[model samples]
Target: MKKNQEIKKSLAEILELPKDIVLDIPKITMVGNLQLYIENHKGILEYSNTRIRINTKSGVLRVIGKNLLLKSIVVEEMVIVGEIHQVEFTD
Candidate 1:
């Protein structure tokens, strides 16, 4: 697995490609404190008004804040919008 990752990393660097895409990892983007987008997600593990936990290739992505709403969700991506305060990853 480590060797495969190393190869992928080298390939990404050589081709000027995104590592996240090459490694099949989640890509997270945030805009101020209003919204967040999680790409390449596995699935949503938990959801509530204040928190949302998304499963990914790396780990469980925990989003914490107020008025957390799942604005959109799909097979490969998800969109979260609210007063996002913190984002973390856990095993």
Candidate 2:
């Protein structure tokens, strides 16, 4: 698996392709501390007013903050809105 990942990374760099798309990884985007956009996620693991855990291809993405809300969810992406304080990943 690691070898395959390395090959994909090399190919993406050599071809000037987007790594997230090439590697099938989650693309995380934040708008200030109020909103977050996660693309290519597997699913939502846990959610609450103060915390959210999302399943991604690489690992579990944990979002911590206040007044958290799942603003949007689709097959390929999710939008989280609130006062985001921290984000972490764990395998």
Candidate 3:
């Protein structure tokens, strides 16, 4: 019934996520006081100089740093501006 429908919807969402990141437990990626990339993010909750907050259905997160910039964001993709140091992440 209703519960089954909700479960189905949730499963569909899970299926849509990148397989490698499906269980990766979303994290906040910060680049040297210049930018932040919240992996698997649902949405932004709040913001300030020293902190940026986010709220996901699974959890709430807080990022602490300085000169934080929102360089770029895309569907399943993001880029940050820093010393361009040591690119990491595999698809």
Model 2 C-alpha lDDT versus the unseen true structure: 0.97
- Who is ahead in TM-score, 1 or 2? 2
Per-model lDDT: 0.93, 0.97, 0.53
- Give a tens-digit lDDT track for model 1, residues 43-68: 98999989999999899999999999
Quote each prediction's TM-score: 0.91, 0.95, 0.46
Question: Candidate 2, residues 1-56: lDDT per residue as tens digits?
Answer: 99999999999999999999999999999999999999999999899999999999
TM-score of 1: 0.91
Q: In terms of lDDT, which candidate is stronger, 1 or 2?
A: 2
* Best-performing candidate as measured by lDDT: 2
Error of 2 at 36 (Å): 0.3
Error of 2 at 27 (Å): 0.8
After superposition, the stretches of candidate 2 with alpha carbons farther than 4 Å from their true spots are none
Instruction: Return the number of clashes found in candidate 2.
Output: 0
